[model samples]
Target: MKFQTIFKTAALAGLALAGTSALAHVGPDGSAHHGFLTGFLHPITGLDHLAAMLAVGVWSAMTTRRLWLAPVSFALLLLAGALLAQAGVAFPAIEPMIAASLLVVGLLLAAQVKLPDAVGAVLVGMFALFHGAAHGQELGAGVTLAGMVLSTAVLHAAGIGLGLGLKRTSAWLPRLVGAMVALMGVNMGLGLLAG
Candidate 1:
């Protein structure tokens, strides 16, 4: 098979895995739990979180030469942020930054602006810190932390895979995805501002 075909297949598989994993994980009765499944489902359940996470993938796929590296960096940084949060470090602007990530990533994807791989990776990584911190805040300390981190890593991989798959499609695909992301971002922004 051709490279494109391989990428498409991998992408599809990744998305399927993500969707399946998401469906399998359910939230605790009334509170957040720190566990593999909970960690994975946490981001998937939140529209704002999902939009921003997926936007990271879409923007990275469109703009960066090292597409895979962008998401990897995001995951790593997110894990670090989670650790920090677990350690009781406070970050005041995490929510705003998360919202901004969605907006900026959406705009980048919509505009089809290609950024240097290093710059794109760094930006995504920085955003991941905020995302990770949010995740960590909800999870109590213990074995659950590790499980949650692992689950988050899987979700991040799934998003990246979905983006890579879309990249192999028609040129307009990214633009369409970008528009959707931007709309989601706007919705999230409104909600955040309201709250």
Candidate 2:
């Protein structure tokens, strides 16, 4: 009987914590996003999206391609996904996908995996869709879209900068960062599931 109570208490506590970090969808109260500043700040406020975005940039910078393929692909596909969301298209398992993206990207960086440029682009593109859709679904106007796009680009650049800067240090630095990102992803994914 004591064990049962302990288990129940632990489970309840876990559920409560999970719910506290949820990235809830924009409700009617969020209709305040009237301009660029709001749009620019939106994605930054979401830890899940921010981590995933930064990982993409770091991975791309660390890639042999050393080109713009991954970031460009993310941008274009993100735009496409946003459009779909605006069109009222519903994607299944959106939150899970978003969380999984960070895990995948972080693991890739930690393992220092290399793939063809096109393939990498495709992988990041998939995540971009979910990320963009999260924002697009809540935004009924294009006024903020442009700002978000610009903000996304800036965030990507910052990640690239971080990756490049880390290159000057021991190889393990970026890998450590990747591991942390992956751990965060796991936390976010479990939270979403528990909630």
Candidate 3:
């Protein structure tokens, strides 16, 4: 089958997954959720978090010289950001930054930009702070932070896998996914503006 066909299928599936949840930071009870399972699922369940995290991995794999550096920087800073938030440190414009991360990461992938490893790591790490801060803001009693970090790592790995596998299948396949991710970012930005 054509790569375009596969991209279409994958994009639809991602959107479907994203559409299942409205907010990234809340549970069904409209309260902050904690614990390992909930933390692990948080990144997967939310549209913003899911797209940004996955895109970071894909971009890292496809562009960075050091495959693991970007992801590791993201993970560690994410933990730091969350820890800071847990400590009552507040970051301004957390949501906007998160949305912008999607936009930037998606564009990087679509453009097939090759960034220096440290640069890429720094870029992703900046976004991870915002993401971590957001998660930290809602952290409650339990081991939720650990679960969220694990989940984020998993999502990143999946993206890296997709980047590696799809690149071998068709060079354009990953670009197509990147475009879709960019569109999701645009939609999210517009939503922020509208709301």
**Clash totals for all models, in order?**
0, 0, 0
Which segments of candidate 3 are over 4 A away from where they belong? 1-22, 26-31
Q: Pick the candidate with the highest TM-score.
A: 3
The prediction achieving the highest lDDT against the true structure is 3
lDDT (Cα, 0-100) at 79 in candidate 2: 72
* TM-score versus the correct structure, for each prediction: 0.74, 0.83, 0.87
Angstrom error of the Cα, residue 53, model 2: value is 0.9
Rank the models by lDDT, top first.
3, 2, 1
On TM-score, who's better, 1 or 3? 3
Error of 2 at 94 (Å): 0.9
Candidate 2 least-lDDT 10 residues: 11-20
In candidate 2, clashing pairs total: 0
**C-alpha lDDT score of every prediction, in listed order:** 0.66, 0.74, 0.78
Q: What is the lDDT of residue 22 in candidate 1?
A: 26
**What lDDT is reached at residue 112 by model 2?**
76
For model 1, residues 99-175, the per-residue Cα lDDT tens digits are 67776777788788888888888987888888777777776555565655565566656667766787786687567
RMSD of each: 7.2, 8.2, 3.1
